[model samples]
Target: MKFDYQWVKDPECFEINREKAHSDHSYYASSQEMLMDESSFKHSLNGVWKFHYAKNYKETIRDFEQKDYDCKDWDNIKVPGHIQMQGYDKPMYVNQMYPWSGREGIKPGEIPEHFNPVGSYVKYFSVPEKMKDQKLYICFHGVETAFALWLNGEFVGYSEDSFTPSTFFLSPYLEEGENKLAVQVFKYSSGSWLEDQDFWRFSGIFRDVELYSIPSTHIKDLFVKTVMEEPFDEANIEIELKVKGKIEHCVIQSELLDPDGTEVLKHEFKITEKNPLLSIPVESPLLWSAEYPHLYTLILTVLHKGEVKEIIYQRVGFRKFEMKDGLMCTNGERIVFNGVNRHEFSAKSGRAITKEEILEDILIIKQNNMNAVRTSHYPNNSYFYKLCDEYGLYVIDETNLETHGTWTDFYDKDIILPDDKPEWEANLIDRANSMFQRDKNHPSVVIWSCGNESYGGKDIFMMSEFFRERDDTRLVHYEGIAWDRRYPNTSDMESQMYTPADEVEKFIQEHPEKPFILCEYAHAMGNSNGAMHKYTDLVKKYPQYQGGFIWDFADQAIYTLDRYNNEFYAYGGDFGERPSDYDFCGNGIVFADRQLTPKMQEVKYNYQSIDTTITDENITITNHYLFTNLDEFVTTIMILRNGVEIESEEMILNVMPHDSITIKNPFTPLDEQNEYCVQVVYTTMEDTLYSDSGHIVAQEEYIYPYQPVQTLSNKKIRIADDFANGVTRSTPKTVGITDKSVA
Candidate 1:
């Protein structure tokens, strides 16, 4: 059957002729160098492409996907970029408002017909000689709204769900010579209503595109789970593998290596079926935590007739996150998530973020004393989760679904999606499954958020159930139930957004059945975050009050050049587009240009794990970390007289985890009459993956009140000024100033 272009507008037609789903993601390698250097078997198709812009489907060139079409003379546009940022369409930002609000009246499953933007992209390339005879596939990391693919003038597939990776097998449609790859992206679709997030509206293939070939006997999917018993003395490592292609004489071998590169466990098995499960137990296993992120590597080898065909490497951490006694604990210690909501954004490229930018964000989070990050509203790039595992940051991975616009105007009516509607159930569930499968392997992910704010419904409740049924190792989070209390069990924790500190405390005290976490709090808008310490103080007072994530980490602004060629960071409404939220998108502690603002200081002080209190004669140090000790930090003391430094000393003290100690002052006061104060600074002892040596983590100061010195002036007058200058005779008188009167 010929490919139908109308499927792009149909809500039910999400995928067509796509490859069979196996696992989230996997790669192949023939040698160790190829495994480490991923560019060997994979080809990146992220350069320029011949592009065509059309206002609507009627104006688009109908035969642009044909092989005989000459697209060489067309304009060029960069892949992994937004069409709006490239001057094809205007960028519009809105919060809880659809882009086509007043321009057109559209239903749930219907899109606008007059002004929808469409981008046609064509790229030509020849298959590499190494992958000619193998099974080749094309992977699109992300695409907006909806897109259709064609190769060599033959229909390949269509896909939606822009956040997760969409992959298609291309070996069946390729030829010997140059092959033409064409993709048509629609800015508005039936899926657009389900994607009304509080950010700018952009459309394009805004992520990496790559072509890869897998070996005959390869691991299609891998899931690793680390189980720890009480007391955390030992752990059981479970490894599951799904093998495909060839399995007659293949043997699967798994090896576990500790953080110090020492092999701890090895198991070998014969591949009889498609799925194989294996387990290994180790005594006295080192646990993983945000404070001390110890990692172990698991390597999988697929052998055909005693020869290695492919190797899969995964980083694993041994930790346990669970709810005990109505409190969330990790490794038997109560975990306080000093977290922030992060958006995958870039100043130059809208949603197409690079590895360097991802690393910089993680480093900034770690340096600011934050230990957790919530992939705000959606799942970020897969590389981000892997980096979190290596760098030790807790992650709350969320699904890509938001329907805030549905409840904006008719809020009293409470009209929302997938509530009882059977048609929307499949698409909503598919989104949840896609996110779970992709990010389930990472140990850093402790919670699976159903989605942002799609309202409470049976569809969302089913998604939460799906997560719990598939994986019982982690918890689920959803803040939508706060708006609709019909399904109170939709989330494991009592989550809310922007709840005042007093109300949070009262709720926890009243109902302690479930732990409370302000999933979204401390809105970091412009000149905002006033009195943020109130919430942080509640964490210490009530055990049920777990820490919450700030609204965001960095501002969502795009770089633009003005008419006079002057460059500036532009926010909402800057592109002269209507239905915008103005500067509402500029609510980040870090500016769009990667610079830290003043609000970060308050965040740093409130999130620090180490607590220090100073008195007149002693300094008391307390360690609140779960798995780290005070010895890992260096403490320096500076003695000041009248705010001027007089003596400096580095103290050597060892405080265990969750312990407190008091030490006497090492130096006596230099001048008692003058004001004396002491400043204590604590910094890391050694370099870590996220911070360097001597990076200040926490500090405190103590001041002593003083009384100023009182002086009495004495005046002396010479009696014989000029006449008796030679004799030098003088008379002296003393003047006293009393507390009651001065003369």
Candidate 2:
């Protein structure tokens, strides 16, 4: 293969010579002893890389991928970083408008010729002695727009999808020592048309890049499907393994370990073919849900001639997610998604988020009573799904395709991709398949979203159908159908973005055939989310009205230094860029620096699963949880007079799931001179990973009306004083006596 610049402008040539597909992301170790430890077969290429920035293709250096072409004066730029953030170019944030709007008159498949930025990166490394004999591969976690790769002056591959991992076989191109790896990342491509998400435009290798080795008898792919029977008691674990390289005389050993590390089921098989399918049955499996995320480990050990060659670990959950009775349910219980759309962003880095940052975000979500998260308009890093699975947050995994700019810029009815464009169908389906293949093993993902704001068309409908055809374990979601009702079946649910609560209610009441959810609602722009409670209240009023995800979780601002040397967060248009969305990117409950805002209080209150109603005579508690009971929470009742607490009592609640209980108020109200109020609070009874014990989950207050005290006139006060002081000389002191009454 040879590198060519023209491929950057072609939509059909998005990927070139990419490596074969493998199982969903996992760390591989050669031996069972090092299974839990870091793999020695992998090497990180995430440090500094020699870089040269060019304003256009013509200005870029020619034959830069050649092994001896560099003159050793190139600038140093950090890998896994955006060139714009490193002073090479400028970051531009535009929503529903192309960055080259006025400068160029290009269409969907063509890119700008004069102003397109090109980043040429070079890294020199040697093959590790341990991995010299093994089959080696290079993986790019993410790249913006499009890019081409060359190793030791030989063309490797080209890829355009920016969110998913792009792997290439490097063993064939490697040298004995001092091998050179070159990459040319383009700022624009045909992929950029579909990537027109409402986010800041950045280009580079903004994610991790590493090299890994594969063993001889390795498991190339593994698909484990947990299917629950009708009674929801027993589950069938179907395992399909795809082996690469040498598989003769190899034995596959599988084990299912419960959460407590107890092995329940074990199976053994001989590898006679490249792909093998096996099944195991379990009785009364512990199903997973947002409330109770019970995970079971599926360990696969490959034995070659009575010796363990490789061990693969996968976490599995047996649960059913389906649409039954016009509602979305999980594990046979109706589910409500108290979710928020999350963008992979940070203050210091644009989209180069760290694991610590992801953990913090998930923890904040859990503490704030959020049960689900939508990966906004694109798929996030592979590790994010694992965190969501472990932390018990339902996920709505979305594909990396959005063409909001098509309709907004053209102002025409026929300006979109994957709608009726046959050329874009393969790209659209490839994105969906990539997301599904990478994130299929996670039980937290309850829905697969086609894309965002791309508008409905045959391509999108096909994408939705592709998801359903591939995986029946999860439901399909696409909000573009709201734009074009011609393809109403593009989504399983009636999904809408930013629609008002009343409108949603009316639609659900009128239709009632499918569940309604606000895919993006309560726009959390600065001081936004007002009246969000109405939507949450609708969840209680109608069964078809499921909850929705908020507009976003955090502001998409980059941290930068101003002229005064003071550091602050910068949003759109701050970097001397035109056609930007400006402060519109600051729509988040949390600030860019990971600080909580006042809006989170309202979100917590509205999204809390427990509903408590307090009155002077009694307190009623409703367990809104689908599976768990209220007993795990400590309920406290407080008596307050004139907004001040007068008495308090605490007790453990025993309300079952989806049930309510009324308890008589235990506080004896004091006959005070002010109105009374009863405050009921629900708190965690035990300490958990995300929060401490006694953390308040929900609270409600009810006020008791009281009669106002009457006021006495000054004349009545004077008359009483005269009687008490025995001042009979009141000279019939005018009943309405003034200060001169003594005269």
Candidate 3:
């Protein structure tokens, strides 16, 4: 493995000497460190590094990780950043195809031989004083395509699959002080075929890198699963624990905190054997929903005899989601998801988005009446799922797999990828396992999606079955089954992309077998999303036509200086690249600058869970939420005559979910037949983790006694020969009197 790079082209050799995948759970040294809210055991390697670029493999520096190599004079590049953005290579944006389309004729599991770029990076650091004499491990959160690592002239490991965490043991290669770390990143690889998503082609290390040390007695991983029964108030919390390292007689103490920071349950476990299992019960648990997001914090304290070794914290939500009577239901009521597809992006940082930016996006999504988001095409950063769980949003977590370019040519079916090819099977299943293991504990993720747009094959079906066999708490979702019905059971529900409402209705009526949803719809490219209410309106006519996610959440635009040195947002082809799909990446309702476009107004109204209707003599308020009541919100009514406020009043109504209430309007009678308008508004009465008090939830307006005006003739004002009389007179056309303006 050290002499050659066969792992780059051989799909069967997915990873070489890499650590096994595990759950992404954080642990602290003590309860005091956990309260400080920072990791005391982890060291960050996310700063500057000496870097060198190569256009091909032949040009890369040889033996760069040798103990005597002097690399201080090399150029400095930022870690967790893409090489193209740092003035090393030109960035290329392509959709539904590989970036090397015209330059090479590539097959199923082949690589481009000529122009693939390589990046050699070197970093020098010493072990943290606290991490010495412990088991040390290095983790790379993400890297594009493929990469190899070395320390002090010894090869560590190699890995692919750019979206999940890859860790390697570093204690054996430990140097005394000022040790060298070298990483070689390849732009394209065999794994690139499975990662052909509709995004910009980028290379290098693009995510965080960390070095952490584990104590002699540590918790390796923890899985928290909640079991809810009929009536759905009580919950049975089951925990599967894995302990590692030298351990003496140990006991685990567990405690649960409610939404209001109150302890509800406590238990003690005796670790008599390996991989212990424990269960606890909570009476009348506060179930979590999008409308009322209730979360419970669980804390575990590990003690060996009389001293505390480690403490772990995790957030849990007790809600039941299932397919009940041909409709998707949460907490025993039918669910409708008002969602949008999201791509993690920024104008300045490319795919390396910041924590502040993620927080801003989540706040905007909640503010605009959206309740769900589909992590379209791939898995996002770990912080994204944590934020969703804290701020309350439903997520559809997708695996990092797509081969859309291969299937577009149906004429040559023999040339498509993963079409019963045995070599590609292991790679696909490994990608699935990596994603499921890292993200299965998130309560926001209700569905596990098999790749996207890679037409259907037996290999795709196997990926779907892997998800089903691993976890039964969540349902499976796949959209490629429409391309081939040989695997009708790939997706538990029938999902499609950009299907019309009438067609969606016809399918549900024709098949009468499964629930239906549009995985992607309402393409929101600049001033679009017209008639989007048609899809949301179908939630009433058909119980199975649940809702659809708008095409996207934000535009994928980058900032580049123009010829005049002025910065402007640039789309595809702006960098003078070949085979570009220009401006198609700007399909988000929110611009790249993090500002909302005018199209958001229509989206806000269409996706609102509450609906209000106003008339001349009556007012109607409806609660569309599946588990909330109208009494939880503050409702106010205001009336205007000719756009002037005549009367304003507050109202009280207690309408249950999926129910409506009608009351006499609080508006005065019209005396002169002026334009009378009525408005109904609903707002939150208290503050939440995501929103503030008095935030408007839903609103509607209506005008009564309105009449349509017609222009029978055109208006004319003429100034004629009066100029000769020293006093000009203007005359209005007499026939225009028939179409007089109404006051």
Q: What is the TM-score of each predicted model, taking all chains together?
A: 0.93, 0.94, 0.95
Best of the two (1, 2) by TM-score? 2
TM-score of 2: 0.94
Residue 592 lDDT (model 3): 90
Indicate the TM-score of model 1. 0.93
Better TM-score candidate (1, 3): 3
Kindly give the stretch of ten consecutive residues in candidate 3 with the minimal lDDT sum. 733-742
Candidate 3: give the clashing pairs: none
**Sort by TM-score, top down from the best:** 3, 2, 1
Worst 10 residues of 1 by lDDT: 734-743
Name the regions of candidate 2 deviating beyond 4 angstroms.
Answer: 30-35, 707-743
Candidates in order: C-alpha RMSD to true structure: 7.3, 7.0, 3.7
lDDT of 3 by residue, 552-604 (tens): 89999999999999989999999998878889999988999889989999999
| Cα lDDT tens digits for candidate 2, 96-198 | 8999998899988888888889999999899888788999999998999889999989999999889988899998899888999999999999889999999
- Which candidate number maximizes lDDT? 2
- Please identify model 1 stretches exceeding 4 Å from their true place: 20-26, 412-414, 667-675, 707-743
